[model samples]
Target: MTRRPIFNRRRFLGTAALGGAALASPAYLRRAYAQSGGEVNIWTYNNFVPEDFQKQFQDETGIKVNVRLVDDQGKQFNLLAAEQPNPTVDIMTVAGHRFLQFVDSDLLAPLDTDRLTNWGNINPTFSESDWATVRGNKWGAPILSGMEVLSYNTDYVSAEEAQTWDTLFSEQYSGQTAYIIQDMMSIVMLMMGYDGNMVEYLDDPDTAARIVEEAKQFLIEKKPLVRKYYDSGAEVQQMFVNQDIVLGHSWNGPAAALITDGFPLGMAIPQEGSYGFVYTFNIANNAPNMDNAYTFIDAVLASPEIGAAMTRASGFISTYKDASQHLNDLERKATSFPDEQLANLQFFRAEANELKYGLVDPAVEAIKAA
Candidate 1:
């Protein structure tokens, strides 16, 4: 959280229902999508929507908000692909790194930004990136932005040893370390002193493939040091609860949640830098309720009123430029980071093709089996 808290950098602001359009404004977007009170089906991660937003949206627009919760990004991607012939959901939540696969497969619709008056409220880092836009058309509306970090039981590991990732492989912590598969692919590259996006090498297939292969072999060799290749945040937290892991690589949200609830834990952005992710809204291909999709996205972008509430529920920060204005000092600290560290925050890159991404799962699986 801000590399460390800077109490004076931000102040607490009361969340008194400023409910307006995006930019946390005193305005509203057109409500044409509410005609006949249609439904907008959304497939999203758990705890992503603020309760009040859901209640207020239905009350004000008469449109029914149907949410289908999804637990994993990979599974969500496959479900979308399988249903492509007759897509069921109107809008889906996706991570920046994974958006490309959806777009490449023709599973998403180009965003109708012209109708989204609040599209300008997005942070440039998200709105301008190649990941969020393609062929000069915006395809995703970024909602949450966060990065992964190395976390440890503060009572067992000193901050000094936790400053870098080498401790994760040290014999002293052997059989006490864990990491998510997808994350380690990029973070391990970071540990190798790669300050740029590792996937960017896909631009030169020869180099990218070689790099991936090397990383795969490296992970296989280190497999014995890892206690588990965790699949979810809850699983990692359970490891902490059972005293099964002394060190782990995890998303910032879960670790922050653990710390807030009085767990003896500490999360740090390692000195080698780390990868970041942004959760966003993408319209499904052939969505039946296209109008409703656009309207719902505007409401989400306009939801800085519950910025702090979202952080409490989901553990990630909003991408709205004025989000800091809504956060109290503590929330602000956990969401923002220092310039030096932020400079090295790399996001997963779009693969050269689906086959490129296809190689990733098996490589990770091979390490898991070994």
Candidate 2:
């Protein structure tokens, strides 16, 4: 599930366990009516709200769509925070890692499944995710599935070289390597076998401090080899296009986009392993057009055709189970995610393990300065 699909089976049982259980996040058993009209102001990735579907939705339901593009979830959180008690946005995309942070910041409203008709069609892996469920309320609706992996210019890197994280830090790729400053640190820690329990080990301040320090120093030492610590997939894509990075740590979406564009890009999950993530739509707490947001969410989930367009456009897998069935042979190849990835993949933790982010961010800044 190796003709392997990018995501062919259920994932996130461990993730769901982290939340105690999936009381509110699972595909709802009850059906609900979908409302229409007015407007839904959404902040999502470009191409996520596909144009053809938008046109059809408006034509059929009279709901006006206003989409504000977002590239980084951290910035998206800040934008919502600045607006405070009255955010101008209606629905915004949130990653699993940032969902708890958003909820803790009081930026999102818990979803009411009675309002989303297609909620039942979502795969349990995404629908029952830990990110959106708190207590008994669900704050996010799953839309896209993604992962963290290594991608390289196939023209430059051999498949054997792409399988190990060591290649990124090796002298062979010096002055030609890149990675995002976020979770990539933890991946490095894991790759180094520093702590099998790295994320949860932060429960003890001393232990977490030591681990963070070690990770920081390692990254600092390796800084010269990196061309950039990029902020977005587009940056990595451009770096590849510009012949700037021979190999880079990237999200599956960006690598898929590169493949679709006919780049000789090769993707690997790294033998040491990586993490998988899901992107969901979180309604702003004080959204002015709440009903329209629900209407739009349902419309998107209800159609596999639109889901197919979205997957083709964004390179992320559709959370709707039937969506990929619509992809053609070429698209299937471009968006292919090997089924064997399940062996080394784990779901990422949300709530950011505060001690980790707190230590890592400053260290990264120091690395950038040095």
Candidate 3:
């Protein structure tokens, strides 16, 4: 079995055909359950579930594992909607904010924590978040967490200067700095003196509109400094490797990948704080193999061994508290955030949807026009 890079665009797009199929038919559902000899079908992003863990689950439970990959949450939701009457996907890894949409649509099943023996091992920071629970019902298990952090080529910029978001907008790096297209809003919000959490600003229409305008103006002002607006972390890594860009924004995983590959790369948690996100494991409301789904969640997701392996493979932090014991010093530093940093981190809350369409979309348009 060949291990593929976790963030390859080619691999993610390879499963596009599956996304177009009308999935929830009675015949299709039956086949999904019966075809793999008692397999559990999981729909998630590529490489989020490591191959070794999949094999381990099958060995212990005598149940085969079939994984279907999607490129993003939008495509995952479209595919799930197609599988209406009885969704074939027994398990899924969904973004924290998207979980609220799933709950609002009645697409997810409430988790039975009683069956998840290792549930108590999860860190309170993740387990206690409103993102994991909806209206007092636990909708999913927090699996991995990460931040959208600043990364700089240490040779080009001092580590001390990279410690603030202001470095990205500095005159010295103009025409040499890069930013992810998707992160514009969060970066702009951080620049505007608002905590990067969109939830707080979204409560009132006046505040939301004001924040939107401020973010737009910030982006427009910084447009000249941005060398490129990339679509993926892998793209940013490539630019850094080629020395095409010296400073940029990146997710922890891709930045860690660069560091592991011996690049003079360093991830920074700015004084304003890093933008955070969590990935949760949720069961389909009409999962064909409910018992096997629960078993998989308990045995694999909650295991410290699995968490350690996943962190080593992907460079994203595991939510299981005991998992830290299994990590080596380097892996621990790469994956885990310090308590002070964690306290300042602003997670991508449920209001990101509104911010995306209502704030970010127009902001991007304004930048293009400028």
TM-score for every candidate vs. truth? 0.83, 0.86, 0.79
Model 2 CA deviation exceeding 4 Å by range: 1-37, 130-132, 194-198
What's the lDDT of the predicted structure labeled candidate 1? 0.73
Q: Which scores higher on lDDT, 1 or 2? A: 2
* Local accuracy of candidate 2 as per-residue lDDT tens digits, 1-370: 0121222112322321222221223222122333356888999986687666676677667778998888888789889999989889999998866677788889999899888867987888778866558768888888888888889887778888988889998998899989986667778777767552356675676877787777778888888888889987767877877777889898888787667656678888888988888888888998988888888888778766666777777778888878778777656776665677557787777644466666766866777776
Predicted structure 2: clash tally: 2
Among the numbered candidates, top lDDT falls to 2
lDDT of 1 by residue, 128-246 (tens): 87777777778888888788888898878988888787888788999999999767887776677542354455567677667767778988888888898887776786687667897
Ranking by TM-score: 2, 1, 3
Q: What is the lDDT of residue 248 in candidate 1?
A: 94
List the candidate 1 regions with Cα displacement exceeding 4 Å.
Answer: 1-36, 193-200, 203-206, 351-356
**lDDT score, candidate 2, position 370:** 69
Q: How large is the C-alpha RMSD of every model relative to the true structure?
A: 6.4, 9.3, 8.5
Worst 10 residues of 1 by lDDT: 7-16
In model 2, residue pairs whose N, Cα or C atoms come closer than 3 Å (at least 3 residues apart or on different chains), thus clashing, are 4-339, 6-337
Distance (Å) between predicted and true CA of 206, model 2?
1.5
Clash pairs (backbone) in predicted model 3: 24-83
Tens-digit lDDT track for model 3 on 1-370? 2322233434333332222221212121111222223778888754567666666567656788889876557557778878876898999988787777777677898988988876887888898876778788888888888888888887778888877889988999998888865475776677777745566666665777787778778778878888988766557777877777888888887677556444677888788776788887889999999988887777665556666655655667888878778766665666655576567677777755755455666766677788
